[model samples]
Target: MVFSWIRKKAADDQEKLKKGDELVIPNQFVCPISLDLMKDPVSLSSGITYDRDSIESWLDGGNFTCPVTNQVLRSFDQIPNHSLRKMIQDWGVANRSYGVDRIPTPKVPVSGIQVSELLFILEDSVESLNGRRCLELVQKVKKWGGESERNRLCVVANGAITVFSAAFDAFARDDSFETNANLLEEMLSNMNWMFPLSQLHSLDHHHTEAAQARLGSRDSLRCLVWLLKCGDLSAKKDSMIALKELVSSDQKHAEALAAIEEASEVLFRLVKDPVCPAITRSSLMVIFHLVSSPSSSTSMAIRSELVKMGLVSLLLELTVDSERSTSEAALGVFDMLCDCEEGKEEAYRNALTFPVLVKKILRVSELATQFSVSAIWKLGRHEKEREKVNIFLAEALQVGIFQKLVLLLQLGCGSVTKEKATELLKTMNPCRPELECVDSVDFKNLKRSF
Candidate 1:
């Protein structure tokens, strides 16, 4: 019935255009604001009709005047033009033969009241230990948040994160609840959507208390690690994403996450063997946060743990032929890891390390270049081990690092980068004359410069 568009009304209108292959839609059906056919047209006090979404968006930007008439709105009320909506639907049905489907009767947008009520239900269900109810509520929350940006704002602003955090803490504390994978999956799905919202920390005091309770408890964090290790692919993706958001710019939180028994290994495996783009990106971001600790001891501990998990080699493989952001992220973390001697030795062992760094200079991004140079400088420094230093700089020159550094100095760089490139050029400059002499002469005829 929905696809039934070979109707008499449309046939009458289209018959006149039989020879012409153009669609002659009536201008009345279009919204002035968007210049597109209105999906849900409503009338303002200015007596002008526009799409509900468009007008609401205009008003949300703090506008008071009507867009078409330029008249001051007496009231911000939107009267639904039900009759016009029906006409649009009928027209769409009649024109289905012309590549038009009937307009769907848009569901009433979720309201703050509706979200609050759902939170009420979420609270009640969790308190009763009602598994079936919790599952239903999780699906509902996911659907509501997934509907639109407006609905997402409503769900999160109305304290969804706090409620979910409290519920997670509760579930993690209850050993029996661990078996309820069905609810866990749904809950994780719902939380994944909410976690990326920037409004997470803007909740009320009540919400903050719940969030603290969850984070302060070791078991809740352990439960996340459990999900990372044991859950299915979807569950793992959601958990990884949640962990990334949870650790965003919070050194204390990231420290705790790294301290989890198997978290480092899990993160390492995720980077080494990616489940998908998102999983790998999130896992890298989570590690980046952990390695970025401000505390000296914690930073050392995290880097040491990552070395044990073989993160340096894993990141090297990820950097080559990866997407811009992931490559940048992997390189950034690897740059941080290179601060330690073990990380530098491990990365220095890879044949691709020097070439990859030189290849990415000015080719990727400033940060990638900065990170590449930092790592190179750190690995290339071998003052006591003079032979190792010579061999390392030989590899650097073989990979055309000499040209890249000169070009970098010419192209301009940060003050620190400029200083480093200048020194590298000066260091390699003296060697160039001697290397040219040795290359042009046979090995047997070559004599020691000393």
Candidate 2:
């Protein structure tokens, strides 16, 4: 009875194909991973079927469980779903007139034996004359690994990070810059993949320490700085991202990065460049992480370089022209810089700093509002400079900064930030009549809060 019903359905499908109608393949026939007809369906220990290539790639990427069931697999073995494959083939045959292509059998996936052999080759290449071969193999692995999460796990499982790190160390040790350039480029490219994967895997402390050590080395630092200056766009972006990851992972790493003389200048140039917004953002992130450290010396070193580089002027420009996130980062960094006297002096010297900071209040994100308020308070608290304070207050009144602060109290802000805003309004008491007369109901309520 079931066989007869199946035959009837097949005949009906063929008739529909003959009439030039589109036949929708059953959802079950589609591979969840690829979202297309499964070429070589296979079942895992968890009883979930997937395209052989997709599942194998997933497993190879270091996943120990099934993608669908999320159940732990007893092993990496996959059994071909021959019955489902036949059904799909039959469907394709019946729909040939409807432009349905036959799903060809897939090739056998990379086996454990092959992975072991590749690892052995990588290990041997460290001291061997097969550096070119080693690079070629690494490139192949990188490309393959990038194709699927499965391949990425396989690469990681095979100790790819350690191999690539060693390769970088080896290339750096060689004095022949011209000779090792290609090799160095390949190693750096591999890092682009390795770093993210390491983070994904939540790599053990030893591996993280090893990576940090390699990146912190003098040779590695010089190479990265050189890459930022001389490498192509992609190389520069990768170097910046790698630096960001290193600093984000550890404060000690950030301190080490800031200690490099070229770090600040190179990052500043990237920020000022208008071509690649991504690189600019990455550069900003690296700077944020550097100054975000608690160490006073680190902040002072970065702040001094930024002040000399005229960071205040650049930040003012970004706040006006760049996106909200960039503006927020600029403000955050600006706020940190203002913690030191040199930073405050530099900011005060920039004519647009106060005006730009005032303009951002209540106009950007909440975080931007907080940073802007803090910055204004920092600048307005010129107790020793009574003359400057009066001059700044007069300027603040003219620019309507006092009016904005009054409105801010009515709008509500964090307690500390609101307190800062309230205090700033009091400091401008000499101009209170000017501030209060700017409006009626709202201005009266703002004064009562003060």
- Considering every candidate listed, which one attains the maximal lDDT? 1
Sliding window of 10 residues with minimal summed lDDT for model 2: 439-448
When summed lDDT is taken over every stretch of 10 residues in candidate 1, the lowest stretch is 437-446
Give the number of the best model, judged by TM-score. Answer: 1
Q: What TM-score fits each model?
A: 0.83, 0.78
Candidate 2 local lDDT, 1-450, one digit each (tens): 665576557657655445336567677789988888898899888888998877867876888998888899997778887767877888888778778997775544555567668867876887674678877887777677666655666666666676677667666665555576666677777777777634646457677677677776766766777778878887887788778787777777777778877888888888887549888878887888788754668767788878788887788888887788888888888887777677777777777876688777777767898999998788777666677666666666666678788778877788989999989888887676764333233233233223
**Runs of candidate 1 exceeding 4 Å displacement:** 1-28, 44-48, 65-75, 175-177, 197-217, 382-387, 435-450
Clashes of 1: 0
Question: For model 2, which pairs clash?
Answer: 57-150, 60-150, 60-154, 61-150, 61-153, 62-153
Give candidate 1's error at residue 256 in angstroms: 0.9
Question: With candidate 2 superimposed using the best TM-score fit, by how many Å does residue 67's alpha carbon deviate from the native?
Answer: 12
